[model samples]
Target: MDLPRITARRSEGGWELEIAGLGPAYVKRLSDVSEHGRTLMQAAGVTGSEHGVQVKVDLGDELNERVRSATQATVDAHRAQLEAAAEMRRTTMSLRGHGMTGRDIAFILGISPQRVSQLLSSHQL
Candidate 1:
């Protein structure tokens, strides 16, 4: 199940946190996020592990946003990396079928000759 998230962003002089359904605004330091979140959750009648809150905080806006963006971008990059590897594996097979040598395939694909041989051997598409 998807869990609810609490967003804490850097504000003037400190950090500001807010819950969607709750009316109160919270301001505190980074270290005390869990305690403050717990307190607010209790106040808002959000009890137990079923309703656990996910806190999204960074080291203030400038630093935090960069980290958050980089974090998500890394996930996206990893997915793209996997997809590119699969495409390369398929392309390697197609090249080998077209009477291409391992060394030639490696040079054109920018991979090692040994990698070309491995990709040629594996049929796990």
Candidate 2:
């Protein structure tokens, strides 16, 4: 099976991503992508817009679901990163609310105390 090839170019507006041989139908499928898929595409170097990032995929034969899933995995990975970050923030705040010192929280989280202070300061808690 041919893995999807990703390339990028700088445009006057922003970065544009090109997926070689991903025809119009596949492009449409990507266009109607889930939020996670969109996040993955952004991480893959496509710039975001109010509507969505504009992807430049080359025309080719029809693509299968397997290929689409392979591409969608990129988006899912990005989504997971976002979820993890949110959870970390919540956990840090919860620990702080429990009267844990910044140093203690840092020790528990295996992060630096300074980093813990920064996280607590930036957040309302």
Q: Tell me how far the alpha carbon of residue 31 in candidate 1 is from the true structure, in angstroms, after superposition.
A: 5.8
- For candidate 1, the 10 contiguous residues with the lowest summed lDDT are 44-53
Clashing pairs in 1: none
Runs with alpha carbons beyond 4 Å of true place in candidate 2: 1-67
Q: TM-scores for all candidates?
A: 0.57, 0.46
Candidate 1's C-alpha runs over 4 A off are 1-5, 19-31, 43-45, 48-51, 56-79
Error of 2 at 100 (Å): 0.8
The model with the greatest lDDT is 1
Candidate 1, residue 8: how far the Cα is off, in Å: 2.3
Per-residue C-alpha lDDT of model 2 across residues 1-125, encoded as one tens digit per residue: 33233434344444344543332112234333334344555555544422454343333335445567778998899999989877777888999999999889999999999988777876765
Candidate 1, residues 3-121, lDDT tens digits: the string is 56677777787777766677646666867766777677777777452566678775666887898899999999999999998898899989988999999999999999999988877
